[model samples]
Target: MALRHECIQRASTIGSNLKDGGPRRRWAAMLVLTSALAAPGLAFAQDDGALDIVVTAQKRSERLQEVPIAITALSADALDNAGATNFSGVVNMTPTLNSVPYVTNSDTLVLTMRGQGEADADKITKDGSVGIYVDGFHRSRAQGALFDLADVERVEVLRGPQGTLYGRNTTGGAVNIISKKPSGELGGKAQLTYGNRDYVRLLTSLDLPAWNNLSAKFSFLYSEKDGYVKNIGPSNDYGELGNLAGRVALRWDAGTGFVADYQFDKGRTRSTPPYYVNPSLVGVVPGYSDDPYQTYRPVDLPVSKTDYDNHGLTLSWDASDLVTLKSLTGYRELKAHSFTDLTVALGLPTFPYNIDQERRLKNREFTQEFQLVGHSGDGRLEYTIGLFYLDERGSNALFQNLTLPFGMGTVVTDRRVRATSESKAAFAQLTWTPPVLDDRLELTFGGRYTDDKKTAARSIVVNGFAVETDIRNRQTFNRFNPAFTANMKWTQDLTTYAKFSTGYRAGGSSEGGGDFTLTYGPEKITSYEVGLKSQWLDSHLLFNLAAYHNKIKGLQIDIPVDAFDPSIVDTQNIGSGTIQGLEVELIARPARDVSLTASYALVDTKVDTLLVPVGSAFDPAVNPGSPFAVGQNIADRFVIPFASRNTLTLSGDATFLRVGDNSFSAHADFRYQSGFYGAAGAGPAVPGREFYHAPSRETVNGRITWARALEGGSEMRVSLWGQNIFDTRNKQFIIAQGDTINGFVSQAAPYSEPATYGVELGFKF
Candidate 1:
């Protein structure tokens, strides 16, 4: 009680100083607040007296609060509360992340963190700036980018450069997905849902604990929804989706504190293609709707199916009190097939054809890490070291039919390509606390080095004539990413910290080549950050704020072929950029039944040297007899696409008592994003065209749940939810081009879904 009063007093003083301050007074206010927040360590401790969030940010188990870094941790409960069915839904709750999907393929997810992400997903060879890791294993294929979270434990989004501890493929940040381990308890659940548009879904899980030291859990889900577009040819227009998933785990806790576990997960999904409309004609057609874009001709002909499977084993041995060893081995495989009709080619009657594409990706990764953590000189210094390896292979095939400009038309073309990549690395990190000043201050540092190799093959066949090419490339670069962090506790309710870190991403080759073989290089970044975590007002409210500045150099950017056709465009190690931002998160529970959570992020990202392709008329002189005849410089035509500069999110949760041992709860959330461009245009002479000019938009969602107690500690829940309640019609994608005349023309139009409402029933045993 005394400590709480002291914290409130300090907070009051700091607030007063802010109201009457010049530059000096502002600094003093910050110091006072930091001191007050850092002093209440005991009161802020978790129930078990351990760190609230267990993180591997430093390659070891450290409390999220103790790690002097900017990050967001979402527990499994949070995911269930938000109704996150896929990766895109996950980003809705995480305001710092953004995902852009293509109209032709909505499953091809492009993720960006803090405005630093790949601008295009069409390229097959370019690696994403933000890396994704599952059970400590990195995923390298873009085609298999989305992963289902059937039984996930937690998700960690570590912002800024994580190259030192994570090693390679993480320029902007890293996403760590930790799946739920096998439980010793025997319990499971079943759920069923129904919504508008003929939407139906079912989910079930079962747990078996008959075997000693071994437990197995299985989960399956199936869902179907009507298409959004009107199929003029099929007479029926409704998109559909179906999914199935399963998982099993085995764990053994041997004497001497040794633990070993193995887990496997398999998932598959078949979905209808996204709806497309001509953006130039949107709003012009009265009674024309975004829902109709979801419709496609020959419905059975245009469909996409994906299969994913992964298995992993982890071994941890607490050899002694001072040293420990951990090893994780995993293998993953993914395959996808997609078919789409050429609606954009409707005007070309000579050859109205469709496209068929297939992709197969496989990866096998093995990582072994050994760390020696012990208290030296009365628990003053701590350290850890580790080694890692990864191997990935990808294969793709494309089939297209070209119609002659006249009735004579019809030519078939097929292209196949394959690529393989391997990487190895070593890393180490350490922290030193002098035990001086009553253990109020701490310091830390870390670094890592990596070597990588890649090879690719391509085959093209036309009129039974075959063309083949093979290329091999290798690169070995040593990077020493280090970090320094300091934390001081001046009071019982607050803590202040500052951190500086370095990160890196490895380079590879362009899988396909037309004219030139593009070579990509590594990208590096350095970030500096400071923040304060505090709780006051008798622990009724909590607020955390952070400010960061990142200087990115040698960033890798993909140059599209339209800018320079016939030329194999690859990633280039060019230009530098800056990202500065402030993040604030508040959680308050004024009453036992009411909770408020609000988060805001202000980000500013800019490119120093903007070098982009501009697609314009072909130039006959440059390439005689080639289709491209007009000449135009398409460089600096448009700002990089899919980057929203501003974003905001707010949510609230309320619970109330109902009739007969029953309870009801309500949840509401809102999300907003600024406008951004969709394509790249040629320079001055050929003003780059704009597609899907996504203006600022906002969405609101809400849900209500009612629960009743059953026999033997069991419970049943019924819930109702609605998404996009406003029924806002928005464009998700737009592809455009021009003909001989300089008039606007659209190649394809894709619109997002409208409002959706549904009811869910769940029972827990």
Candidate 2:
């Protein structure tokens, strides 16, 4: 009762402060405090003593609380309640992680975590800072990470360097997704949802015990939503997606314990072109709109369709009580064809031409892992040793069509590219629980070694002139990423730890043409971390905090070249950078029916060095015989794109269980990000313009669910959910080039989704 009174008093104080301060300041203060207060409640609800979170951070199943790593685990139920149907939704609720979907193309998804991420997704060679894995299989490319979830068991996001255990791609961190296994019980569930924009979704799952020691689970999901933009061409607004998926698992307890599972997913979509609203034209031009409001052009070309498919399998054997072996194999194919209108040619005597294009990306990967885990020295020491191997291949292509006067007809330009990469690694780790000190202190140490190789090929055809080139590159890199950590229990409910670890990202080549080497060296980082995890108030409140500093070297950067004027420009290897950040997460269940969750992250990243390309003084043919030739240099140092320096998230849920076997739950969530730059340009004249900017924005989302339990072991649930509830207007991309001489370059305007509301119906047996 006293605690409830204190909460009421605090709420009143907050309301009083809001009345006395400016709206902006008051909002900021409220967000910070609310996030701080809700963190403990959220953690407690997710990590309660009723169930233990099992994670494979070190290739071994262990309790999340005992992993000695900074991580967050979300169960399938938690994700469903949060309405995280895709990768973007997952990152939206996660701290220190952000995702950007190409405005013109929803098929392209880019993810950034811990201040380290890719600047451009258009390029084929560059890889994301963080790596994503599914069922122990590595998804080396971004396309696969954008897939929808059907029957996920749990997801674990490990922060900091995971190089010692995950290897090669763990420079920033890793995301591990565990899918649901076949159950030995016959059961099924189905869900249907309807929303604005003619949105509809259906998801169903079935589990069957086909035979003794063998079971299978089939899960499928389908979704479609009309585009927000109206396409005058065919009256089809575009934005729509459909998917089909299935999985099968077999298990046998032949004294050796073996399990094999396979999964397949196919999805396709036709999305609207990013709506680039010219702020200058808003309210000035007739029918011009911005943000929650939308406007369209009579002749705008609709985005073409894109299709993607992926299939994978996992095989594992317990071998014995002391050893385990696993193998993951997968194949993926993506095809995208679209038409982009480069110009309106408005107010002129000409019509717009289409930049008709097509792209194909394919990847085939196989990974084999062997792990030996057991106890030694009177069960005081536990250790794990692993070996890993991976192989991947990918390709892309783009084509364009232009219109000319005097009946010159149409001209087509083509660009094609391909890449193949392979890697092998070995890792080992040991954890010791000291016999003395009442087993209060545990120590862990590990290291890994990796080797990588890559090859790239490109060809371009313009005006019937064909140019082809092949670049063969082989780089063998060996890294001994090591870590040392100590976990000590100070009291019955408190634990603290400090760790030092190393992370690495392998080097790769570029796709475009350049006389110089397009490959950059690997980037290595050493991280220093200190954290504390505490459970107090009789396990009702949980507090977790971590402070980390990452020193990175050999940063890779892309420099765009001017196609119109060959001598105009190109890109190069930059220098080094550093990132320092602090993260806090809290969850508390102060009352039996109420819970709150909150998290905050503050990150500061800066560039330390710059690499500039050196060119000849003058090229008479291209430079018009000028004595001084223009070259490239890195000027805007320390600018990191796609990363918000400050972020705060807060959410709360209140559940009420009453008579008539009914329950009601209400949830509200808020997210905020500071402004940051998008591209890397010096003066903006270079082709494939380098630098762009993004403004700060905030969004709120909420949902309410009501469920009733039936007498015969069945239940029904109905939910209403809303996104972008405030209808905040934000730009996801900016194009800074104009077609005409008049400085009127068209900005490829991508607006955030307007307020959306939906109703979901779910039935379980």
Candidate 3:
């Protein structure tokens, strides 16, 4: 069959037929959409074993080779092959991509792509540089993402600016997670795992038999582990992990060209922050060891706890042969209480007990979207039109204790804050394959217009005295993002394309603690890309390459509002920059069950313009945000965090040792990254503070599995896997803090996770 329609609807699917003219245009779109509804959905192609992979990169089901973009799709089997059970593990070595877990191992994620990402994901009011979508529902806050990937169908990572199809906050790109739906059958799978450091994990899934066109599914996971670093002090070990989560899904097929899917997920997580060990204090502190895996236990700290719930419902109807109407509704909420200890005070002695830091955080968001997908009767033109709305509410109560010098009394500060936003947008994209040039050329144009209204309110009380009753501010921003693309097919297996796109990251009120209320505007990105997709060796070898350049405007620079306390931030539009990158990926299959893959990305970031914030002369008594008295521009001195100059991934998989109904397979992978900086050194404040540098590092992971085919359409498998098998010790972060009150500097550098090996047993029927 030729590529004749936007969707691959089965002929058995019965849909409405209509007339011509504008009516013809409308009916054509419906026909193309109803074709897709004949089945529940199309699964994106995974890594390895397949040349022509299916993808929904363009909102419509299409071949991955035909999509004119840079994307890496991984299916469930691919994940299992790589022994990936967490979000960070799934994208560990993706080209042009960087994924980092939060300091406290919470549910938040910092995803940097093509050298663009959010530096401070801890701030609740700020938006991430990349966009994350789950089953057609956009996630507003990055704080409550899926810390563990369970029962996921596939994960697609799209590089470069993707604003035309996805909305704002996609200056870098997007990560689309498509989960498994109810299969309308009685089947299930379960796995149990045990690893080093006393780790224990369990995962299970169940599918109920279909009844009256209704299907239901359930999944649960429990994971816990001891900290990698030993705690020698009064508190528990550092970097501990404990998590429990559950998922429920329901699908209703009306059999009248309509489908409804409802999904709900809840997770409870508890963990301690990564143990901080500073080289400067390695020997000076009492019982401080230079080894990254050992540390003098903290004096007084509390374990972090977080609970979140996410729910989404999708309703779709084949209104006619020319158009399909779809609606998505999503609701997510998070409640968390955490404590952070920024000091390593092993030598200091205090008689009084006081609280160091505490936070009670909460956030909730609701989103609704309506979409119309269609194509022309001749299948020459395809289009998508959508309207989106999102409302978010966030609240936080912060408290901290500071001890004065010379045995003085402790001072306590309290602040309560609330932030909310309401956003509305309309977006459209159209693709036309003209009759000229044998219908091999495709031209596309897309655009989105968005309006956002945001509000921030803060109330402060100092030692039982109300300083600021309530300081509230509201701001509104509007913008239009556009994209253009030209793609061509030179042969059945060769395609090339070029694209230009734009996106923006929303901004809001800055938490400046003084009398003034500060706010910043949205930051924007302009990106250009060229890509190639080709196949050779008679479908045994596949190659994909892409190059892109991105320019950023109104860079949102976050600075510490308080010198002693680094958690509070004052955001500003202080700089602009440009980023260019190149990505190359290749996969080769020498036999029916053997594959080799290589993916590499090279990126460079440069500042176009960076200005010093206008401020009064630095007076230690009056000003704390920064000490720079405005002078010459220092654009080149600015820092970019979580960006590696060079990244490479190499992997191989083979299935051998075959028996009558059993076979063994082995998988191995190596990941390498050049030097990358952590957070910018205190936002250009303290003396000699700039980029928090971390040296280059590499890791190796491997897994071996044995599978047996059973009667009655069932299978059983056992796998042994190990991550960081070499136990390489490498620093992953360097957070610098200027302790002016203590008259010294504190450096917090934490190393990557140690080696871990586990065995998993799974069965499906």
Candidate 4:
């Protein structure tokens, strides 16, 4: 008990690790800021040693530090330095990002910013709260979010609600993955990486010089790795992964006032699910001692597969000095099928059928957007107006049958759900710098008017009872969201701002209930934030800080119809709460050869109200003495899932030795995240159904690189990297039930990955 309290106390201290007025703050802000700004925007670099980053977070290219919203931006070098092959690889360094990779399988890489994101038990028909964009193309679903980011330029993470100007309305935040464009130069790079567990990856890219005003680029990558968990039979071990991805891009400049860019990409992945283990039977597996990575493999547990293709085209024309017209068109398609064996990990070999549980997801998305961006003639005012449209169609299917112990009987389920969404919106943002205080004070106004038309159809059969068969329903929702901000440049090196914004997650009919038209209202949030961006010590340091509070209404909450199964469930707008947090980032170059960056965040969630009416199943009056925990006031004890209280990251790099054309450098990072609740359901605080809290875990990652200039104009490099060097195996995911009788389809929980090390060889010309 004392240890638990100590962990909680350490995690709750958000302001202690932060020193007062340290020079380190600007380093991360600049590390994140300058790269984002330097790659795309126009920012002044006072010192050659200092980073100059630019960004388009506010629809305009400017210095990241000067932007009003809090942004964490890093370049490809930073990503490669940290060995971040995908977004989840960078989560430890980002204080605000929270991800759940073991949601259903590895295919579902769900990410949420600021405590609110995609829920593990979220309905298949629901959309994620956080918006992810690839070159301004919004990805509506989280199914293919983990695809390898092959040739990327820079990544920007916006930490506040940006629904006012974005094409899609996401309540949490946004992540923009920007890939490098055609450089019109003849150059390419090939690389190979080999690691333990038979891990191997190959990547190559080529850029062709411009010809007849046209430039092109091509890139491809292949990666595969054997799983860590030892299986009992001839089947492959759990957590194995294999993937292939490729991309082609073209650019055209007519020498007129117009330019066009087109890109097409495809990716496919095959992987085994994480080996889940029942704590009670951990040491019973063959050939391995008690451990999270050891499990009794179910025979013929086929691997899961996910495939996707994307096409995007953008056209821009300079109509006049004051206005530039642009159009963005995109089409994306994805298909995924996954199989999981639940009973095998729980020592239920007699239960036939290998669980026979699988989920298939198919989705298609089309998006079109038009934008007019320019500045006023006087140069004191700027504006961006856009028209956006998105069409999404998706189908989700689940098939499973579970055999339980203690004569609990066999439960079967075969469900299919179809949903279609058409969204249209018009948005405008205007910023004006008055003639006061030397044009240092700025006022910005932005708003978005959106209309969403959605429809859903469901076919459900539980234990051959045909609860709902081909039931369909539709609904339309509209809202006008607005934002306002005031920025005051206290000095050339520091700026302070305050803003208010509102965002919402659209609600639709569950399309269930057999013949009844059941529906829920949209989840809404109103947020306020204040922050400062500063650069000091001759631009060698950058620091950014922000604090925000959000009030939520009609928050979406879900529960199962039967306590033993989650396949069939109901979603309601029952609970309301508040989420508030503080974020700090810093970066500094203390010596000419050394660099350091750090970031920390503190999030607190409070449930203020939960409406459990007389007829609701959660009400004590509705069941009196069932497993519902009679007389329990859920709102008083409810907790948000996977929302860690404290997160801290520290990174440092030193180029201690450099001789002529040869150099050597080493990089290292430390990461810490407090314990958090991880459960698939939020129920009436009943026994064996209450929220599960995972203990806090921390680890360190390091890398060392050697580089030399080749005989030609090419460069050769070698790198050694390792993750989780100490191999802390903490249970980050768990759902337990002490049975008197009934059992669900899955009763096993997953643990964290073990330590891993790798080596890379690369040649660039």
Ranking by TM-score: 4, 3, 2, 1
Residue-level lDDT tens digits of model 2 in 1-765: 554345434533533432123455346445434432332112232434332346777777776556678887776776777777777667767778877766436656667778877655555555667888877667666643456777788778888877667634576778888887777678778999898987787888888865866677777777777766555455445344444445554544443477766776666655544545444444444454443243355545555566666677667777666556666566656666555443221111232232333445555555666556665636678787777777777776766566554566776667677777777888888888888789889899888887777676767777788855443555566667888999887776688899999888777666553543446668788999999888767766566788898988777655434312111123344566788898877665676666656677778877665544343212234334333224433333325556677776666666755667899887666667766555444223333333245676677777789999987788999999987776766767554432211122334446666677899999987
Stretches off by above 4 angstroms in model 2 are 1-53, 253-256, 269-273, 280-296, 299-311, 334-356, 401-412, 469-476, 563-571, 615-638, 682-691, 737-747
Better structure of 1 and 2 per TM-score: 2
| Candidate topping TM-score | 4
Best by lDDT: 4
Per model, state how many residue pairs clash. Answer: 33, 20, 10, 16
How accurate locally, in lDDT, is each candidate? 0.60, 0.63, 0.72, 0.73
Name the TM-score of candidate 2. 0.86
Of candidate 2, the 10-residue stretch with the lowest lDDT total is: 343-352
* Residue range with the least summed lDDT across 10 consecutive positions in model 3: 11-20
Q: Kindly report which residue pairs in candidate 3 clash with one another.
A: 9-35, 27-322, 28-322, 29-322, 29-323, 30-321, 30-322, 30-323, 31-321, 31-322
Give lDDT tens digits, candidate 3, residues 661-717.
999988777666776766532233334443255666666777889999999989999
| lDDT accuracy of residue 52 in candidate 2 | 34
- 1-765: candidate 4 lDDT, tens digit per residue: 342233224323432453331233323322322221111111224434475678878767788878989888867777777777876765666778877666456656657688887564324567677889999999888876677768788888888777867789888899888999999999999889999998998999999999999999999999998887777678877777877999999999987889999999999988877666654443443332345665544446688888999999999998988889999999999898987766534433233222447888899999999999999999899999999999999888888877665566777888888989999999999999999999999999999888999888888888989977778878898988899999999999999999999998888655322232566678888999999999877776677889999998887765444444434345666678889999987665544555656677888887677756334455456545434453344574355667778887766666767899898988777666777765424323434443255666666677889989887789999999998876767664465432211223334567777888999998999
**lDDT string, candidate 1, 1-765, tens digits:** 453344445444433422222443333333323222211111223432222345665656666556677777766656665666566666777667777664335466677787677655544455677778876766655553544566666777877777556634476788877776657678788888899988877777777674755566676767666766657665345344556777777777676678888877777766655555443333443333334554433444455777777787878887767667777777777777765553432221222233333333333334444344444545677776767777766776766555444355555556666666667777777778775878878777777777767666667766567754444455555566777778776566677898888777766555443432446667777889899877656566667788888887775654343321212344455556677888776554554555545556767765555332122123455334334324332233323456666665555556666788699977666666666655433222233344335655566667788989998888899989888776756566544444212322444455567788999898988
Ranking by lDDT: 4, 3, 2, 1
Q: Give the TM-score of candidate 4.
A: 0.89
Q: What is the C-alpha RMSD of each candidate to the true structure, in Å?
A: 7.8, 5.1, 11.4, 6.1
Candidate 3 vs. true structure, TM-score: 0.88
Give TM-scores for every candidate, taking all chains together and pairing residue i with residue i. Answer: 0.83, 0.86, 0.88, 0.89
Better of 2 and 4 by TM-score: 4
